[model samples]
Target: MIRTSLASAPLRVLAADATPVFREGLRAVIDRTVGLEWAGGTDHADAIRRGVRTIGPRVVVLDSAVDPTCTLIRDLVEINPELMVAVLFRDHDRSPASVRVAQSSGARCLLSRDTEASVMVRALLQAHQTGRYVDPRLTMVLSRPWQSASACDAGVLLTARQRQILALVAQGMSEPDIARHLDLGAATVSSHMKETRRRLGARDRAHAVALAYHVGVLPLRPALVAQRGISPVRPAHTD
Candidate 1:
């Protein structure tokens, strides 16, 4: 059953699709919805991260075909763990492999590339508020899942501390704040972040977030729209 919650605040949303037409079309649908702030849209993963951090949107919708790699999801979650990611897959070829990849990267909702605007809006609102959404069809497939964890592993073994750091980073915690929370020196935290990036082959902080999500190291949350004229929610203050 899909659980519903009354949002105490508004949800800010950022969307990215490789194509302008798709982005615009989705934008129009989302724009008409109440209690949502369209925080702008982009095509690049790096740009998406920047927008999320700066805008602090609670939900992000992405195109799976354009940004199919796990890195796309991982990076978003790594930088904004609280942000929910919704993905649209092409209806013609909604393969299980693609669905699993999307889920592994923390996509809360997966819809057919051809999903109707109303359905998309409903899914978006659900994901934004609760961090979980499932297409009935996709849920049936996931129900059969029994793969060994090793089979799903990507070989990016992380230390326990590294995992904690990645999760916090995904939650949008600043490096200094993470250091303070971890009770470690800022320089040491910096070193860890640098090393983590190097190991993930990440190009930058945003890239690191993408790479982490790509590898299933982080997961997307629910999508929530902010009320009209209200500011979006930021990650909880770590100070």
Candidate 2:
């Protein structure tokens, strides 16, 4: 069972953002927070991994602009499943695809870069305590009902192998990397990707992932919804 209580000590927080200014700014806010500790910040994924090993923070706030596919987020969580990941996305960068990728990769929270300090703090606390926190803004996107039955039907056309490839794609894996990981040929991986896109009628890989979430091929965890204190929005009726 997952532990629900906050640690007795201040929750140690680390940040990874490519921008030096933004990284330090987050570090300052974390340090100033009452029950949080600023473990450190880094400007790259490698450094972030090194920092994680060195500081052992309970939560890591990642700038999605730096790692848009959330591959780093997935890698970090794989290293330590208990480590809460809070992804920060720039305003224009927010989309169903990015949100789905972060969620699928085990991110505990998603917040905007310009989110209020108070809200960030709450997100941090909630994520650490409850194991999930989706931004209220993105909840609507996640809850949107399929516009047509064909969209839902499209989901069933994907083979299990196709689904596996798409899941990795959502996590931001390159075709070659995915090929290597799955022990398949790179050309075969490409073929599956193409077929998956065709089956979903997705314009691109990202669109495919967004559609996956929409059609229930990639499900949003119940804890994500329960912790947010909101019900899933009902689908609009099409007469």
Candidate 3:
């Protein structure tokens, strides 16, 4: 089958940030990437609302500048229930506590502004397909004592091993593959996966990945993935 290009893409994407430069950067990424269209972007929340209503994009890459607390994710979702959002973490709002709040705000994807373009694309695609994703780097920040205390005072924490296993799982790695990659027996990897599920209270692999997005521990570089059979979900919309 021929690859899909952005122009023929069934769904569009847009950027929403206060900075003109940031919007341009997103536009560039969208222009260069396949499977997405640049539906244009805005610097205001109201404009973003209008754009979503008008453009009806499948995904939006947003900056916390629209709302420092990242509450806008929920509001944007309210406007278009099928829309997926990937939040950019500015220096000011990249704290573990803020990131946690943003992730908790139903943000499926959270990545630093400087994350690689491929990661950004993967994030937008991931959230669009699965409803959850977060840059694994953010997990380091959240693992800190102060960050965890502030973000998840409930004290729900995953060990580094657990985090690594979950990250591999998110990469669509199988138990044997993960075991081989990590230089561990298949049983060991299986045990770790089970424990991770228990810690995250996930019903299965998919649920565990979704919950990992909540705790800030999946999807990032240094852990490569071959995401196969990924097809975007384009919901019906009215003109």
Candidate number achieving the greatest TM-score relative to the actual structure: 2
> Where in model 2 is the C-alpha error above 4 Å?
1-7, 146-239
lDDT of each: 0.67, 0.74, 0.69
Query: Candidate 2's residue-wise lDDT over 104-176, tens digit each?
Result: 7678898878888778888889988888898887776555443234334434457889989998987889999
Residue 209's C-alpha lDDT in candidate 3?
71
- Give the least accurate 10-residue stretch of model 2, judged by summed lDDT: 227-236
- Cα deviation of 164 in candidate 1 (Å)? 33
- Using Cα atoms with residue i matched to residue i, what is each candidate's TM-score against the true structure? 0.56, 0.62, 0.58
| lDDT, model 2, position 186 | 99
Tens digits of per-residue lDDT, candidate 1, 1-239, equal 12224356546778888789989987787667666657889888889878878888888888765565555776778777777888877653244445665686678887776787777777878776666787777666545432223125523345567768877897889999999999999998888888876555454566566545544555444331121111221222323
* lDDT tens readout by residue for model 3, 1-239: 11232344445887888899878888887777778778988878777778888878888888876755444676777777777888888765565656765665667788888898777887777677777888887878667665443233322466778788888888799999999999999999999888876655454787567445544455324322222211111222424
Best by lDDT: 2
Angstrom error at residue 39, model 3: 0.9
